[model samples]
Target chain A: MKIWCDRANNQRVAWHCRSHPETAESNAYAEVFQLQRSFIGTSPVHVPTVADIQVVTRRPADERPAVILLELPNRHLGCQTYPYDDLVQISRLCRAANIRLHLDGARLWEIQPFYNRPFADLARLFDSVYVSLYKGLRGTVGCVLASSDAAFMAEAALWQRRLGGWMVTSYPVLIDCERAFNLNIGTFERKWRKMCAVAAAIVQATKDFTTSDGRPIVYFTPEVPTCCQVHTHIRGVTRERLAAARDEVERDLGLSVFPWTLPSPFMHELDPDWVLVNGDPLAVQGMDQYFEWSITDKNVDIPDAVFAQGWRAIVTVLFA
Target chain B: MKIWCDRANNQRVAWHCRSHPETAESNAYAEVFQLQRSFIGTSPVHVPTVADIQVVTRRPADERPAVILLELPNRHLGCQTYPYDDLVQISRLCRAANIRLHLDGARLWEIQPFYNRPFADLARLFDSVYVSLYKGLRGTVGCVLASSDAAFMAEAALWQRRLGGWMVTSYPVLIDCERAFNLNIGTFERKWRKMCAVAAAIVQATKDFTTSDGRPIVYFTPEVPTCCQVHTHIRGVTRERLAAARDEVERDLGLSVFPWTLPSPFMHELDPDWVLVNGDPLAVQGMDQYFEWSITDKNVDIPDAVFAQGWRAIVTVLFA
Candidate 1:
C-alpha cells in the first residue's frame, strides 16, 4: 500500500479517501510517509461521492491530489458498498481529473456474492488493487497487487527487494495460498447465506431489549448486511460488562458469542466534527459496544438457532 | 544493513570500508540509499590498516565519516581475517574518532574454529553486528542483527514495520532456523577439519599442471584452509571450458566438482588502480576462473580422495 501510494502521488503531496476507522491508512500516511495531517482529504461515508472528489481535488495544479483510495464494502461501515453506478461515476471522475484510483480489496472475496461481478471486472475500475491471500482465502500469509501499468509493477518489485520482502523460500506460503484459494473461493456465497440467516435470528431475539435511556439494546449497522460481515452494536452495555457477559456465557453455554468488543469508535475519529453525529446514537450516548461479526466455512455448520441462543444468553447476563 | 547504516551515519554522509568484490555494499550504498559515488572511501585490503582509517577519517568535523563497515574474513579475499591485534587497534582508532563501527559477520560462524573466541567476544568489537542465520548455520533463511543500543534497535523495529518485514506468521521459519542452528553450529570445527583435508589433497593433485602461459593451473587463494570455505582459482581455464569440463566429469564419474565458476573479478573493481595488482597473478593475466568452495555436513561424508579425483579429471578434460 505504501509503495502504491508513494508511486501514485508522484511529487504531488495530497491524497483523498473516505473517512473510516481503519488503522492501516493512518499508519501509512502519518507514520510511514510522514505526510502532514492535512494531506488526506476525506469524505464521511462508505463510498465518496463525485462531489467529494471535486472538493478534494479543487486546488491549484501543483496542490491537487494525485490519487484517491477506496475500500470495497468498507468494513467499518458494516460491509456496506457503493451502488455499482456510484462507483462507476467515481472512477470516471478520477480518470477525468488525472488522479489515480486504488482499491483496498482485503475483504473482496467476502463481498463477491453481493456484487455478483467477476473479480477482474471490479479490479478494472481502479488503477491498482490490493488483495490479501490470508483474509478470506485462509492462506498462511501474503498479498497480491494487480495493475495494468508495467512501470508501476516494476517499481513495486524494486521496493519489494528494498523492503526484504523477498524471502529465501516462500514455497510453503505459496502452496498454502493455492490450496486455500482453490478450496474456499467458491464457498463464499454459501457462507454469506448462512451469515444472513444467523444475523436475522439474532436480531429477532434481541429486538425487544433496550438501554436504560430507551434506545434499542441490539442493532446492526446497515440493518441488512451487504456481505458476510456486519458490525453488531449493543447499546447500554459497557465494554467491561460485555466482556464479563461474554466469558460467563462461554463458560456456562459452551458457546463463544463474539471474540471481543470495544466501545464504539467516536465519530470525530472518522470525521472532523467536534460534536457527535446524531445518526450514530450509540457513539453520542457513550454506552455502546460493537464487534465485527464475520462468517466463513468454519462457522457455517452451526445452526442459526444456536447463534440466537448464544446472543440471548449474553444479553441476559448483561442486563442482569 | 540499510537501517543500521542510515541510523549510524546520522547527518554526516561519508563512510569508509575496505574495498572488496562483494555486491552487497554497492547495492546498499548506491541502490538503496542513493549515496554519492565519493561517499564511500575505500582501503584496498582485506583488513584496513590504522593508516587507512586515518586517511579516510581525516576530514573537517562536518565531513568526517560517521561509520566504518568491516566484513569478517573478507570472502572476496579468500576468507582471510584480520589478526586479532590489528582488529583491536582499529577498534581503538574508531573509538577515539567517535565513529560507529559495524561488522558484516555473514561468515562469522565458519570462522569461529580459527578465532577460537566466543561469538559474544567477537561481536563486542563493533557497535553493530550482522550475522546470517542461513549461511554457515544452514537455516532455511533469515539473518540477525545485534546492537547494544536500545534506541537503535527501536528504530530498526519501526523500519521493520514500515518495510512490511513483520509477517503475519513466522513460526515455520523460526523453527527451521532453530533446528538447523542446533544441528550445524557445533559441527563447524569438524567440517573445517574435513575441508582442510580436501584442500590439501586438491593442492597436491594440481601442483604439476600449468597454464599455456606457464602460470600454475590451480591454487587455493590462501594456500591453506582458514575455515570451511576457500576461494579455489584455476589459472588457465576460461569459464566456458571449466563449465564443459564440469559437465563431462559429473556425467562420467558422477562427481560434481564445483557448482559453477566465474571469470576472476578484475582487481580494478575492488581497487581504483587501472593497472592490475602484481600480487594477483591470475587477474593480471585475465584467464583465471574461481568459485567459492564451502564445506558442510552434506559434502563432508564424501571421501577427500573423491574431491582430488574429480578436480584431476576436470583439469585433464580442460587441457585435452
Candidate 2:
C-alpha cells in the first residue's frame, strides 16, 4: 500500500494524532508511538484513547479502512456515566456505515467489579474476546482471543500467527487464566465494593457544599465534563482568610491537610458562576469539617456566607 | 466469499490434509479447531504439510482468500533446524507455488528459547507477529499483534475489537505487559539453557555407554524430550531390575530417585532399541558429576559380561 504523510518536527500534534513528525517521515509503516494526547492541553500523561483512534480512522478518504477497532468500555463506567465505549451506539453506526467494530478488552478482568457482574457475562457481548493470562487474573502471561462465531476465530488464527503471537506451552498461561477464572471473581467483588464504598463515602462527606446554583459540591460523575474542570480563584477571599477558615474547620473537625494543593479562595465578584470541585483530591477531613460547619454551627459562622448562601450537599456516588 | 473444504476429523495419523467426507460433516466452512495436536505421536514426529496449495495457487484462485493460517509447535518441543514459523520456508513455499502463508503464533514466547535468537530478529522473518500479555509474559490477558505492514495492523485491530478483544482500562494490562516483557525474557532464557544443558549432558553420558545401536542401561537424548521418556535394554532386566538399577545408581551416586519408575529386569525385551529412563534428573551438582562420568568413563566394564548379567558396580574412590 503506497501512502504519503507529513513529518512531525517537535512535540506537536499531527494532523490526525500527536507524535514525533520524524517518525512518520522515516517509516511509512511504523507504529506512531503515542506520547501524549491533546486532552487538557499540554498535560504530561499517557492515555491511549478512542478519540485518537477516531481521528486516525478518519484520516483520509482513501485511507479509511474496512474496519475500525476500539476497546469497549464496560456497559457502565464505575456505575457513573461518562464518555464510555458505546458498543450499542457505535455498533449501530458501524452497521449503518458498513464499517466493522473491534474491541480490545485486555482489562476485562478488572472491568467486572464495576457492574457487580461476572466476566463471562460481560465477555459474551463482544464479537471476539481476547482474554489475557496474567493481567486482571495475574496469570503468567498469555491470552486466548475467542469468539462465539467459530468462523471468525478460525480465520483470526492467521493474524495471531502473523503477529508472532502463536506460541507453545500455553500451560503457564492456563495457570494464570484458571486462577483468574476461579479466584478473581470474589477478590474483584470485594475490592470493587471497597473502592466504591471509599469513593462514595468521600463524595458523601464532601457533597454538603455546592456552587451558587445549588449543584452538589462533591458530586460523583460517571463522565468527566468536556473542557469543564476546576481551577484556582483568588479574588474575594484572600489566601490568608481561606487558610484561617481552613484552620478553624480543621480545629473543629480534627483533621490535617497541606496548605498548598488545597482549593483556592474566591472573592464574590470573581467567584465562578458554577464553582465546580473536580476529582482532584483535596483535604478530605477538612472538607468534611467545612461542610460540618456549614450545616451544624450557625451562631459562630464566619462572614463568608457565599459558601453558606443556602447550600445543600449533593452526593453522587457510583457505588452505594 | 464462498470457499472450499474443511479440516478432517480423521484420527491423527489419517488426518493429513485432504478432502474427506468426514470433513464435510464435522467442519462446514474449512474452520478447524485442532485439539489433538498437543500429542506429537511417537519418535518420528513430522510436520503435516499440504501439497496442492502450491500448484493451485500457480493460477491464483481468485475466489480463495490470499492467506492461509497454520499453528506452530509448543515451545516445550523446542526449536530445531527448521524453526517451523521461519518465513524463509513459508515464503519460499509461497513463492515456489504462488501463495501467501500466515502464522498463528499465540504462544510464540515459549518457542523462543529453543530458537536461541533475538525476538526482533525472529519477528522480522514473519509478515506479522502477535504477542500476548497473558501468555508467558503474564501481561493483562490480551495480544499485541504486530505486522511488517501497517495496513495489515489497521485491518487486524478491527477484527481484534470485533472479536471483543478491545477493553477500556487496559492500562492494567499495560502495567502487567511491561512486567511480562521485562521479567520473562531472562527467566525463559535461563530455563532454556538449563534444560538444553541437561539434555546434552544426558546424551554425552550415554554416548560411550550405549550398545552399538545406541541403547544404554541409562542414556539421554538431544531432543530436550519430555519427562518420563524412555528407551533401553539390558540382559535379564525386568521392571524390578530397572528399579533395582535406578536404586543402585542413586545410592552409589549419592542422588535420590524412584527405582520403581525405571525399566526393570523382566520387562526388558531380548533385543531392546530404546527405553526412556524417565529422563533422569539430578541436582545441579549431580548433573556436573554426570558430565564428568561421561568424559572419564569411556566404557563401563560390565562385571557379568555374559548372558545373565548381575549387579553393576564401579570406581574405587568411593565417589558416592
Candidate 3:
C-alpha cells in the first residue's frame, strides 16, 4: 500500500484529537484529555489548555492517555507560557501513568526567555523533542528531532525517508539556519521583555477603547505576554476598521500589522469568533474579534518615533 | 496507542513480506504478491521481482492484491526499465483486479528515454506518482506527489505534516530545484546516448581484462545499459588496489571516480555481496566484488580526454 509519514508538527496537534470520543473511529484506543486551549496560532489542531493539564494528568493510571503532547508558549490559543512547576507536574504525572510525552517546540526558541531555563532543561521533560528551523528564527526549512533513544532515532531516519523528509542536500537550509542562529542569539530574550512592556503601554494609552470604569477597552490575554507574542480581543471597533488600521500602519509607516478574522483554518478547532492579531493591531472588526501580535526582527528595529506614528494611525483608523 | 505512518518507500518494499502466509496474522486481509525482487535500493523491504508482476496480476480477482506499486528503471536492481507495453498490461490488470497502482518514480526522469514517453503519459498509468526533486536532477530536498484524486492529495498533506514533511519555508529547496531544472532540462537525453556509447567503447577496449573466450574478467549488466546506470562485477583485483585507482583518478586527473564497497546502507536491501562501483573500479575486495555506476551531473561534464585517462587508471588497477 502507498504510505507516508505524517508531519511532526501536525502529528503533535492532531494526536490530541485521538482522545475525543467523536473521533473514535480513527483513534478508538486513545484516552484524550482536552486541555484548555493554549496559544497555537491558527494551527488546525487545538492544543490542551494549560489550566487543564494538571487535572487531566491526575487521572488514574488505567484512565490516563497513552501520549501527552505540549507546545511551549501555546502560540495558538494565546501566547501562554506555562510555569516550570506546572510542566514538572505534567511530566511527573505522565511518568506515573507510563505515558509518552512529546513536545512541539516550534516556537520554543521564542519562548525560552520567559522560562528562565536552558533549552536542554525544558527539553528533558519529554521523551522526544522537535524544534523547527524556520519558525521565529527566520531560517529556510529544517527541523531538529532529539531523543535519548538511539533505536528510535534510527527508526526515525527510516520514517524520514518514507515521508520524503530525506533531502539529498540540506546545505542551503543548514547555512541559512546557521546564519540566523548567529544573528539571533540572545535576541529573543530582549524582545520578550520589550514586547510585554510595549503591549501593556499600548493598552494603557488606548483608554478610549476601554470601559468608562477604567477597565481596558481591549482584552489582552496574559495581559503582560510571556514572550514576544500577545493576543488581543478588540472592543469598540469593527472588523473592517481594524483591517483598515492594519493597512494604514503599513502604508503610513511601512509596518505590517498582521490581522486575521475569526474562525481561521489554523484556529478552526477553537472558538470560531476568535480573531488573531499578530504583532500590532492593523485592522479587525467586532467586539469578539481577536488577533495576535508578536515582536519580530522586522519590527524590532522600528524607531520609537516611527512606531508611535504607526500607533497613531492604528488608533485613528479604529476610532475615527 | 502510539501510532505513526509507515515510511512509504520502505513500506512499499517491506509490505510484501506481510503477504507471506507466515505473516498473515498481521496482514490477515491483505492479498499481497510476493513477486521477485524489483529495484527498491537496499531498503529493508524486499520488492517482488519484475517477473512476478504479471503472474500475480493474473490471480483470481478475490486473490488479487489491493495495491500494486512499481518503480521505473528500478535503481537497486540493474537499472531495468519496463517497456510501455508491459506497463500498459500491468495498468489494465490492476484496473481489472480493482487494485490501486502507484509508481515510485524516483529515477523515472533518468530512464525517460528508454520508454520514449513523456512523464505525464507514464504517470497517467498509476493512481498516483511520486517524483523526487534531487535524484538525477541533483537539486535539494523535496518531492511532489501527483494524483487525479484531489481528496487523496488533501489526505496526503495531513500525513505529510504528521511526518514532519511540512516546512515553514522550503524556499531553499525550491530555489535549488528550480536552478537544477533550468540548467539540466533536456540534458539527460543527451547524456543517456553518450553514457551508453562510452560504456560500450570502454568495455570493448578493456579486452585484456577478459579471458580468451571474451567473457571479461569483469561482469557488466545491461552490458547495454537500459539507462545511464550500469552495474559491474569486477574480479581479479584487490579491493585496496581498486580503491587506490579511484584516489589516483581524483588526485591526478582532478576528477572523481566514486567507488564504494558492499554493505552500504543504500544497497543493504540488495545482496550484501553486491558492491557498487559508480564510475570505473575503485574500492572493492574479492574476485567476486561488484559495484554500480550511474552517469550523473557530477561526471557528465568530464572532458572525453580526462575520462579516458580515468578509464585507463581503472583498467590498469584491476587487470595489471
Runs in model 3 deviating more than 4 A are A1-58, A96-100, A148-152, A211-215, A236-238, A248-256, A263-268, A271-287, A303-320, B1-51, B211-214, B236-238, B244-256, B263-287, B301-315
DockQ of each: 0.38, 0.03, 0.21
In model 2, what is chain B's TM-score? 0.47
Share of real contacts kept by model 1? 0.28
Per-residue lDDT tens digits for candidate 3, residues B1-320, read 01111222212221232122112122212211222222222222233443456666666655545556576766655566567887887788767756677777777778888877787889999887877777677777667788887877776665545434454456667888889877766777777876787676666556577754566765566677777776665555556776777787778777665566442223223234433435222232243455777677767766555555566667776567
Residues forming the 10-long window of minimal summed lDDT in candidate 2 chain A: A1-10
Among the numbered candidates, top DockQ falls to: 1
Q: Pick the candidate with the highest lDDT.
A: 1
- Candidates by TM-score, descending order: 1, 3, 2
TM-scores for every candidate against the unseen true structure? 0.88, 0.35, 0.75
A217-264 per-residue lDDT for model 1 (tens digits): 878876787877888988877788888999999999999989888677
Per-candidate clashes, comma-separated: 0, 79, 62
- Per-residue lDDT, model 2, residue A187, is 55
Q: Give the per-residue Cα lDDT of candidate 3 at B40.
A: 22
lDDT of each: 0.72, 0.37, 0.59
Comparison by lDDT, 2 against 3, better one: 3
